[model samples]
Target: MRRLAFAILGLFLAAQGQAQSIVPAPPQVAAEAFILVDAATGFVIASEKPDAALPPASLTKLMTSYVLANEIAEGRLSRDEQVVVSENSWSQNPVFNGSSLMWIEPGKDVTIGELERGIVIASGNDATVAVAEHIAGSEEAFAELMNQHAERLGLSNSHFMNSHGLPDPNHYTTARDLAKLSAAIIREFPEHYARYKELDYTYNDIKQYNRNKLLREDPSVDGLKTGYTSEAGYGLVASAKRGDMRLISVVLGTSSPTARKNETRSLLNYGFRFYETARLLDAGEELEKPRVWKGQVDYAPVGVLDEIVLTLPRGKRQQVEQRVALVDDIEAPLAVGDSVGTLTLLLDGELLYQGPVVALEAVAPGGFFARLWDIILMWLASLFGG
Candidate 1:
């Protein structure tokens, strides 16, 4: 009996030691739906019912910002362009509407830049409506444009009923879709994303500060948007970059402001703690030397079009591997950016992302005489054994 008691005690101690060495607990979040994604690779780090559709509230402004960025990029609108505030924007706001506002009187002129500041820093519903009207000529038309852009971005779980994320039952988006949208904005528009980090903006002398508490909590937290309503609850789409790793986290339908902040912070912490980013291929890294039939060079260098970076869990770096393949015998004429081959990333034997390798420079077929000689050689070889 004494020996058995001692053995049991030893077994219990070993069990405890093993438990302590296991993976740490995941961070806790209070939101009803949430997702954390690595911005570089689109790899989902953590998600909780990320696909469930819920009210987006003012988070709809992310789509608004995306549209504005594209317009600015295309030269259709300028930051200095003036927009007139209509009765639609001012009449709905009183001291009681709980809406953020610049308190513009009807016919007051506001610049596109100020409108962007109002939407981003103040979460102004009126600002959203005004910007939408200015951009598309009507809020309804702007909503259509928003949905079209969402479709182009492959936001499958999203639908837009209004420019402002009001509590319309039809206006809904999934946490996963929101994260994708946020990532697209950050990846596609670096210059425009800078607006999200501004702590305060003065419109008509009313200084409105950004409500995203995470930006104040962590300097690395730069963007993107926040939302709240009785029906939609509190939601936030937040992003931060620490070193080479950038992450986008979305929390939807939280009970309170504190819960939204806490959940977003926890999700970001969890993502940063357990994951690290690795660059598998540097930009312009040559992958192959495909034979060129003609032109100035005998071989054309095949290289990656862009750097391939991935975010992986800690201690799993050794598991990341890549395979490069090139097209069979190249036939001369090739232009820069022409797809030549592919570099596939694999983790634990599962394909992650396949990056296409492109031709570095143009290669034209050789002189007519050289081409004729090659054709004759090929024909003769096919015609006779000798």
Candidate 2:
């Protein structure tokens, strides 16, 4: 009778835990496609049609910026240098209304720095075209460069046909791909990413405010870009960092600029409220020191090369469990960064992460006598289950 009562109590407690741990459904988002992701963990907090191909509009400038950042990073371009604005990239080269010009008239020299500000803060089509022409000799070639980068970044659902994100039937990207791109920009080139936060830029005596309204409203919304076109509707790829936890949101094909802003806020709010990203282990954090057979060192330290972070329901971080799957007979000579084992983290027995454990330092082979002794010890351990 006591055993029956205990079993029932245990089941009841488990059921209660499950009920308490349940995460609420992600908030409903009204857009053609949207995604919210934890920047550090690359975990999707909530998403709908993230991979659906859709027009990205001026958000293409992010890629244009990314390519330019890559160029500067690789020493092909410098910020201080200047490029001449061609007739094709003059102020009169207006297609879309508000973003038509940065006053970059024909045959004038503009520094790379000003052009970047013009592109990001002013959303100038002329500045983007000038950059495209200066870097790749033409927009067509620059687009090829963009596509190459897209492929390298594993943006499977993205394709770029122009440097400026003016509406073209073939120029399209996905919410998931844009999220990845934004994260990459923030992670890889922080210096350039910082430019996205500036409120306004002045070129040729005309100043315009950044169209990303969220930056002004939310203290956390530091950067990213906004886009609009007849086909793409209004799109915003916005990122905000409340603390160490940064979130990237993508809302595409909304009815108006106001809709995109509110929808993005909804996604960000849902993510920050319900989920928290935790860094479980730092790079080279030794999780185990396993016995090394036939090596100079009796024990070899193993750990991850990169930090491991995960996004889980808020307040549930303490419930995670860690496990190691390493070889029993770790014969050496082991080199630094050699694969030693696998480390896994689980929540309620559900796998969250599984990655390789590498040797923290090299281990040379032992002297002949030491090796013989180790072999004998290994043999005895196998026989006696030591």
Candidate 3:
């Protein structure tokens, strides 16, 4: 069970007076639940019932798409590979009435790339099952991979029981988790994400448009998915970018497709209107170059492992400040990714975020004479309280 790991840094900023009302109260929405988050910082700007595990409908395809992207990235799968559609994928049972489909003929072979577009643009339930079977041999097995990925992503309130989100009591996810997964897709797999922006796709002489209405209605809104079912009302996971800031909005359990799209638009609009993000530190940007005692190199460079980004009130960007507290003395035998210091962000005397400052490169032990000299120098510096 691999997990997303980050060293925790203690925040020492003291509380000032209460902050001014930077952003207005969020708009009341018709959806049962929704969330707005900063894609760069994973900061929740506003949310309602973000943790409730309700029916996700076809929004579950985000995870399915994520898994496919991961396999391609890891060299285990290829977009050009042809996958044959299984009978199980083509036939929607009498009890189950699926939404949109790719209309793939049983035993027909389709490229993984085409299937991906079918899933993204057509919201194809048949294409989803074909990809799942091709990847993991069965929908049940692919679902295990989905659950594993969900747990690794720290989605405590989410679970997956199938590839195409045809109603299952066990297949459910929260708005917050959907936002995180969408951000991961955008950040981790930019190449595949472009398909989300595609408005129309044609397969077997049949043309279908993306169900996410926001793409046509708003230029800023780019890529994401929309879902619907009798049990899970119309739902959408949408993302939009204005300037340098990107936001993800998730709305679940709306009465109609128009309602889900409208609700998601309101959330995205509120986030962009009231909140902004600033990139404080680029990945590998040197924050400190400290002296290393008894090492091959005299200095060791360190920085935040990933880009440091912050989301704050619309007009509060100038108030952001940062500080780093490093180890008193760095010794030899340092690994490339060791966390040797802490970095904290503060705004108006309040702590905003913190993460470890990691070594940028490895440091090996120095020669005997060099080691001896550094030891004496270290002692002398300590004696003088330097």
Candidate 4:
């Protein structure tokens, strides 16, 4: 009876391990571009042709949100600031053209908050124009600001021609850049992002629903925007959080809204279903001590630059291990935060996260006598060419 119980326990453990290895199924969509990313760690969970540059359509609003949120955070702009609609914004540029309202007459008043809601909830090209004109004095100037912010955000595959994300030869972004931009908005502007999740917002006595259908489909999805144009096709940038794990999925150039939502949902679901976040090392946890030469202390304690965390699947922890590599005998006079080495977490021989190991405490060369002796020895060795 004891032997049989032990055998059953072993089988149960083995079955649990097998279950943990199961990964979420791949998304089914006809999108020309797609990307899935773990929002917390900025890890790329999956991607298919993520770098292909395409017209972003209304997805360009993500950049607008980034700029607006930054301005608000810095107190440069207030949400209640009233903006007067300009004729140029109403006129619309012929070169970069898309749907808009002839009814948004010039000389109308709208608050900054309304302008944001107009664009996000209504996908109003006119609202984008109004906000751009109010903020940067003109859409041309605003486009320059958008490109600058893109550069600052390290969006290598993005360029902005207009604020409204109308089809312009120059207005382009890739799936990866869009995902990065979306993640930045959520991380840097949590307060501003709250508006994106609003299912319906009323402006000028007109009720408008958010174009992002996933918000209605999945309660977990809270913030994001959707975009489309004749040339750009249907696109959606959606973000969702389940527990501490959040993911951003971008699907661009899909055939239709239903397809975009389905693909985005699949990508996000795969991320949540398969990946499990594990905290390996807490902040200030000493990972190792490396030998030091000619220092007051014989060795220096090295620790994670920040808390070490990873998003992985269950049962994979058994295959995970950290390898520490430190500089061979760090010289004296090392300062805190100095890079000493690196701690690499590996799973199945694949590198997951490589973090810098830094000096936790400063180590100066010993007494004056010790320093002088070291200098003399170095000089003698140089003179003798030894």
Best by lDDT: 2
Per-candidate TM-scores read: 0.80, 0.92, 0.82, 0.84
Inter-residue clash pairs, candidate 1: 294-366, 295-365, 295-366
- Tens digit of per-residue lDDT, candidate 1, span 23-137: 3666777788989999988988888899999989889989988898899989999999998887777736552287666556677888888887788788777888888889898
Q: Compared with the true structure, what per-residue lDDT tens digits does model 2 show for residues 1-386? A: 00110111012234353645668898888899999999998999999999999999889999999999999999999999899888788877646455545788776779998999988888888889899999999989999999999999999999999987887889999999999999999999999999999999887889899999999999999889998878889999999999779999999999998999999999999899889988888888887787888998889788888888899888677677777778667888999889877777877769898888889989999999999998899899879987
Q: Give the TM-score ranking, best first.
A: 2, 4, 3, 1
Candidate lDDT values, in order? 0.80, 0.87, 0.86, 0.80
Report lDDT (Cα) of residue 250, candidate 4: 91
Candidate 3 C-alpha lDDT tens digits along 69-182: 999999999999988877777746432354688878776678999899988889888888888999999989999999999999888899899988988898899999999899
The residue ranges of model 1 lying beyond 4 angstroms of the native Cα positions read 1-25, 91-96, 288-300, 325-342, 355-386
Best of the two (1, 3) by TM-score = 3
- How many collisions between residues are there in candidate 1? 3
What's model 3's lDDT at 249?
93
